[model samples]
Target: MTVENALAGLAEQGWVAEAEADEAVSRRVGRPARRFRFRAEAGCMLGFDIGLHKVLAIVADLRGQVLGTRRTAVTPALPAEERLAAARRLGHCTLRSAGLTAQDVRGVGVGTTGVVAADGTVTRSDLLPDWTGTDLVTAFTEPFDAPVMAGNDARLAALAEHWRGAAAGTEDVLYIHVGRRISSGLLIGGKVHTGRHGAAGELGVLPSSRWDTAPGRLLAHWADPQTLFAAAGAGEAKALAALEDFADDLAQGVAAMTLTLDPELVAVGGGLSRAGRLITDPLSRRLAELCLFPVPVAASQLGDEAVALGGIRLALNAVERELFDVNG
Candidate 1:
């Protein structure tokens, strides 16, 4: 096609706009090469995470810079519809804070605590009451006015770590998200691995695995892990012992994944990752003892925003594929 036809096509598709020709550029490239530039202000993306304790919404530009975020508490007893409504409110609030509307959103990405199917349905969930089998895509469509994509919260957090956080450069990684519940996400050959049944990294489901019980038992007496870690740091005997037991339990699951995948790095993320060295130091030591070889482990720098950021990445990819004809 001729340059005129090409420019016209791009303009028709709302991808490019004519800009004022600069004198210097016009002199060098002959008439400024028509001065067409990509329309970057076209739209943005919306990313939200619906967790057991809270719902967080983030608005990011196409380039993935977080513009704004809004969070709302989520009680376990709240109905699924109410929880979804809360998510919607937070999403709109984030968009408003970012000085944008739903119409400016290219796509919406949602991460929820559950086994998510490819079509954005929650296959199962126990973290939040009445959350199983939710058609999340449909639920968010009206509120966001865009195509919606959804994934498991832990898995999405792993994706965020891989994309721009802890596991950024690694081709193979094991991400363990430790919070009120224990779950994991796997990245193999630089891609998120969800397994045949979409249940990869669900180590907590194993009856013999301490991943299911250790954290809860530890928290039953202490207000939170941070308190226990503080006590352990201060040389308290009971706290030290409790931390050791928790580390040992966590290490068992890490060792199993290490032996199976031999990932380049193991990333620990989620709400509990904020404990920093308090958790990583002992967990690394125990992991080294359990593994045949020492595996490098790091805490997620993204903290609680990991899943929401991952949702942003997902939304970006979806927008690119649908609007830009680019494949991720």
Candidate 2:
């Protein structure tokens, strides 16, 4: 059956349609269906991450318990379609290793880095240069006949940190995903607040004095902010200066966000975040200097897996139609 039919089968099997927990509840209801008699059955959700070097897929049950996971390196020289086809096969193998089949998968969620359009198009991925404008929804949904969901990896990492990891129990939170580039995600009132155009968290585009506009691309790379921090950790004085300046700039960005949204906490993640005090300590002090509210900053609990886990969380909640609005 196709994904639409699978969802219909779910309803036909007596599963109640619940509002997305991430969205506000409505008093309005759809036409009630005649109660069908069917016992509850165990099912699974698959969370997949397509990255520059490797593809990671995680499998979990309705309750969010992880069952199995698989990862494989990719040959970057290949075309986008070939890479996607490889991902599909890897996903199938991942499920097979978990003793399940594609039909048994209720939903699949993907988290990829870079600009994700509203209609499920992944534009400008740093890892997979060829994947720009790739329609991931069609790629997974057509063949597997299962509902597929996709989002920015950093955004979902922020969601996962809020829901099941470090930022758990917070109502308003911020997560800065630091890597080759820096991006951020926000959870306000416990829901991921992606702005209009689906580009709110693209911090790399945020202006910074450290960047050079002459070459154009130089400005983009310098504005990332994380590069400075990484440089500092690598023992470069010039880079450290850039990082300190970037920290001040980051304070400005964080301050603006705090003034507007007033998040209760902020957490840092990604490969660069592992540097710890080289980044967080200065960041905390700067945030204090810039903001009126005194919210604490911490590191991500799940590290690199945060985004993948967030994908799993997204799928599980969607399949079970459970409340997913809150951070914890």
Candidate 3:
């Protein structure tokens, strides 16, 4: 088709609009090309992170430019219905803040703490009360009138890291989410490696694994991992000891994964990753000791937005495939 025909087709599809030319061009092009541009009001997408203690909603454009975000605190003790309602509220609020509405949303992506199946069902959720077996796709679809995709938060964080953060340009990665829980997300040959049962990264499930108990024990004395790191940064003996123990246990899990996959890079993410040198310095040293070869480790630069940004990436993928005929 000619350029005119292409422009006509795009105009008919509401993707572009013709505007009067502000200036005339030289005669390299016939009659100076008519000015046409993408529509000003292009559709956007929503990315939501429903965590154990908070719900974060992000609104972004097709190009993944985040316009606005809203976060609301939530407790696992709340009823499932209440938690869902809170998520919805935050989602709408984020869209409103972005000057968009649910009708303008082309797709929705959700990241949650659980084992998410390919169909967006929560196979299991130990962090949230009564969240297991929830169909997240349907939950968002009805309210947003958009296609929905859901995945494990840790796994989605890995996706974000690969797309625009710490793991960018790498094909294989081992993403360890160290916070109140221990989990991982693997990327093999540039694709997410969700195990057969969608629980590939539940490292804490290993029988008698120190990952299962170490974080809890440390948090028992400190309010959170950050506080513990603060104490350690101040050279408090107990806090330093706890961090050393935690690093050793974390390295054991990392080594197990390294032996199996031999990933190109290891990215440490999640809330605890904010500790920066406090955690990375020790964890890197431990990984070097455990692995036969040195493995590069870095803290997630995306911070708390990693999972939500990953959700945005997922939403963009779905919308592009369905509406733009492009592979994600």
Candidate 4:
């Protein structure tokens, strides 16, 4: 009975094909044993990183292999509506580049710079106030025919790190993101720990953490962050001292989380992670003094693509549900 339903669902659904019947196998089992092959191209998933400075879109197959990708520059001042339009256009372009269509997208997942609600709405966004109240589901719905969901960019980056990046095998991780924004996300028991309001790992919002404005202090010695980090890498006096101080500031909030949550590992991601040792080294040293027990600090292997890939991971999750759900 179960075999009949399995064949009917898989074959009729067009995601799998039945094997040829063998009389020898029938004689051995008293019935035909069927084998099926997974159709990797049967459907695709769309993932997007709608960030403060850019919008990134990635197209992937059921197997999580990235097929095509596109990104567009945006700004914090760019109106929310304009940014949404640019992102949607990128989605269309990315799908076309992959030789796929909107109908082929089984699910769409987004990582954006703000607090995402259960209904995929941005309830609050300190970086982009105009983005608040935007319905992310509706934002992508016009561009594709599929289920859509959105998550906080940093949180999703944590998911990506656990999926294939720095914290891949670690079950408990504290993912710290320091870019245009400073935030963190948690993976407890190998799962993305989105709190009750989808704001669990948000350490910047606290007044004492001072993470929201610490970048200003870090930039006091140099006008541009990239230039300052480069100088620090070369062992420049002012840049090094300033970065050390900044590292101390960054570690303060991280220590708070470490003492409380006691994550197994700490991952530093986002654009600043491109600085590599320039950022992670000082952060590691400061965390050593601040944390009760030593916690490993690692730079992101995925670099700028972490959040975009996390978006892909999320979309694949949704696709798997649709593809594997016999009842649905």
Candidate 5:
């Protein structure tokens, strides 16, 4: 009865609606039960993933269904105002395609490559020179009169994985996003664990992590990671050896986090995750050797959409908190 009442209340709010009755499968003698369907258009959630090279925007319905999306590539040196304008352009495209206006949006979430403070300010950013200290929340607030939030791109990718990707159902997860720059995010006990400064799993900041020196440090002397990965996938010997060296460096940082968090699994994301076994096999083997115990490693299947999708998840979370009893 309580569940029915809740459903009724949700229906009143236009979140759900009665559907065609299922007459083919009747449980009570000959009478069939009425069906209810999620009205995804009840409210919209806007999500954005603003990275050093790309900006991704998405419009999702209340049921987390992605209605529309837009992705654009940009130079890393682009200024903050230009970047925000690019984001705004992408946001408008997504909303237009989704047949929604800003008024239909209930919440907005943004993910960027930096340490985000509590109020959605980028406290520090190593990639974009002008991104540091940008008031992301304020920037979003002026355009969208909705609940706005911001987070680190890696952390949002972790949230995306835990929500619907590789780490689903896991309580503790360590997500490493390996791109030109390597960063990390964690989920401790089914929740995103952002420390006091929101830089809890920012391993790239540590000089010992070797993320910065990895450009010419692949050991095999072969440049171009894409072609190298392709060659490795084709079973080239030199690329294989270089990959092993890179994996060893990567394992050092991953091992430290694994020993401390003892997470159930480590998910590798970002554009590099497409390498499949060429990367995870070496990473898994290296993790086995360096960690205190066996730590499972899974490559991302979410592609570049992980961070943007995670933004949608975060926006939905806030909407759910305000509209429904999440804890109950």
Candidate 6:
């Protein structure tokens, strides 16, 4: 079928096309002119960042304008389905606040804070014990009736930064979130590189660590990094020493990826990113000392919203693929 025909079909089916898809493909492949069914200004896209304490839902249109947003906290101890239901309710509330309904939404994109499989399952999560291997897509799909796309929260944050925040215009970039846990997200060629098994960028637990101890035992030292940072900020000498040591170890991990991926820029996010140069400067220097090449580092501009915006991008991509795949 012709591109225009596919575009019309998608629009009729309540899916909005991406404004840049055809242009991007044309520029990359030098193909004949094609278009997707996208509104210059139409309905909004919905995005959700499902976190341990709360679910954040943000809505935006094709022009990247945020229309409405809502945040709701729920018990992480609840079952995965219960948490997902709460999340869906939050999305509905946000849409209602904007004087719209689920029908008005183009698509739903989600970034879950844990290891997310391609099919939208939470493979594992220390933050949300009830979400392990839970199929989150199924939890919301029936209720919402819109197409859904799910991805790792950290990776989505990287995607958001690349598209609209600090990493804008960069094709090769690494976005690291250093809040509750340390995880890295990769953006190669303007897209998130989720690995073959959709397990890419799960960097919180070091691969070299033994896994037989216990479920959460691998990260038993988790609190140490935060405590060390707080002490260093307070000018404690011992804390300073510990912070420097931890920074060195983080640099080693980053350098290992640097040697392999050679990303152009490294953008750090999450609550700890506010530490700013305190962490980045030392880490950058250490990485440079250990690396064969120099790489620039920056802080995320969007802060926590990076992953929420990433969900918006994922939803846009999903609409294009499911409803406007001209190649299909």
Candidate 5 residue lDDT tens string, 62-172:
888889989999999889999999998898888989888888888899999989998899999878879999998888877878889899999999999999999998999
Could you tell me which residue pairs clash in candidate 1? none
RMSD of each candidate relative to the true structure: 2.6, 9.7, 2.6, 2.9, 2.7, 7.1
**TM-score of candidate 1 on Cα atoms, chains taken together:** 0.91
Best by lDDT: 5
Instruction: Report the candidate with higher lDDT, 2 versus 6.
Output: 6
How large an RMSD does model 5 have? 2.7
Off by over 4 Å in 6: 1-41, 207-243, 322-325
Worst 10 residues of 2 by lDDT: 209-218
* Candidate ordering by lDDT (highest first): 5, 4, 1, 3, 6, 2
How good is model 5 by TM-score?
A: 0.90
Native-structure RMSD, model 3: 2.6
Each prediction's Cα lDDT score? 0.86, 0.72, 0.85, 0.86, 0.87, 0.76
Model 5 residue 54 lDDT score:
92
Q: Model 1: how far is 49 from its true place, Å? A: 0.8
**For candidate 6, lDDT tens digit of each residue in 272-298?**
676677778877888889889999988
Best candidate, TM-score: 4
lDDT of 1 by residue, 1-328 (tens): 4778878987997767998877664276354456688776677888899987889999988788889988989888889999998999898889999899988988899999878888898988967648998999999998778899899988889889999999998999999998878899999998789877678988888867789887787677898777877887898999877777777888888899999999999999977777777778889898788888888889998989999999999888887776557355
**Could you tell me the TM-score of candidate 2?**
0.73
Output the lDDT of residue 2, model 1.
75
Task: Tell me the RMSD of model 6 versus the true structure.
Answer: 7.1
lDDT of 5: 0.87
Clashes of each: 0, 1, 0, 0, 0, 0
lDDT of 4 at 168: 89
